[model samples]
Target: MTTQPERLQHLLDRLLRGVLLPEEAEQLAGAVRDLERRADVSDAVAKGNLRHVKQLIPAVRAAEARVHELEAEVSRLTAGQCTHSLAICETHHAKPVPGCPYPRCVAARATGRAATA
Candidate 1:
């Protein structure tokens, strides 16, 4: 579910970095739609329009936080830090908190292979 947005963002980020083409601008609509849905859902529960109030209320808050995080990640990648070390890359591994970048085992495996090679 969350994978689609992350994949699209990565592809779009690359395309923009390469040429900033209008073709790449084509994704704006879908992005806008996604954000709109997120916002609408959030507002519905927040303003007391939606049912299942107790369960939905928390879900809405979480969605809002996700929007903020995605916005920041877009900002960061747009600012030309996309090529930074994965160790420091935001959202690299999807750890609930920040700074997970990637798993330690992947690095360990790579190092193990390199040492044997």
Candidate 2:
């Protein structure tokens, strides 16, 4: 049987050490449940589009994944030449034009042309 002051001191020490009694833990859990019950995320959960809300994390993640794929495809296609002046030859000429910027131009120029450049 502890004195009243000793019990209070022990309780304070336990609290300072981050220890909670069963009743304290139960009360805290109940308070948290109440807060969650009253919390207002219906707009996010109901809208379902994740627009203009904190629930857009999954949507943003999906968009970022798509962007990564597109970026990878662009990198593979251009090999970092997407920014340069590359064009496909629509003329269907017998030989590629000299100094053309297309990747296949050199091969096309060499195949059927006798030009040495």
Candidate 3:
């Protein structure tokens, strides 16, 4: 027997190939509803986790503050370094540099225009 996910994939493949029959359409709808239900449950669980984290934050306030300070120090130390490499052109307001291997940069260089923010 096919799992819900497998059935969903099959239904999607059939949908992409042609119109679904009435029963197939109903099946697809059911699959979509099931997926939505799962997503809702996941969202609720995430929200519960977030609430738990928030409750614990006060207990770890000192540690959290130290972490923030360390993060700031690291940022200051790396300020002069190019962390993103050619992905951002420092001279061009963080736009991709011309001749950059990234597709957007290649397209920009081809058009003789700097990428806009």
Models 1 onward score TM values of 0.30, 0.25, 0.50
lDDT, residue 55, candidate 2: 74
Q: Which candidate leads in lDDT?
A: 3
6-113, model 1: which lDDT tens digit per residue? Answer: 867875777768864566556755677788999998997777754567668899899999999997786455324324554433334332222222344234344543
Question: Candidate 2 on 64-105: residue-level lDDT in tens?
Answer: 999999866653444334224443343333345555556455
Task: Report the error of model 3 at residue 4, Å.
Answer: 1.7
Please say which candidate is ahead in lDDT: 1 or 3. 3
Q: Give me candidate 2's TM-score against the actual structure.
A: 0.25
Error of 1 at 57 (Å): 16
On TM-score, the leading prediction is: 3
Provide the clashing-pair count of each candidate structure. 0, 0, 0
The residue pairs found clashing in candidate 3 are none
Residue-by-residue lDDT tens digits, candidate 3, 1-117: 999789888889989989777799899998899889999999999999999999998879988999989966654433323345543433433443423455555566577665443
Measure candidate 2: CA RMSD: 13.1
Distance from true location, Cα of 7 in model 3, Å: 1.0
Worst 10 residues of 1 by lDDT: 93-102
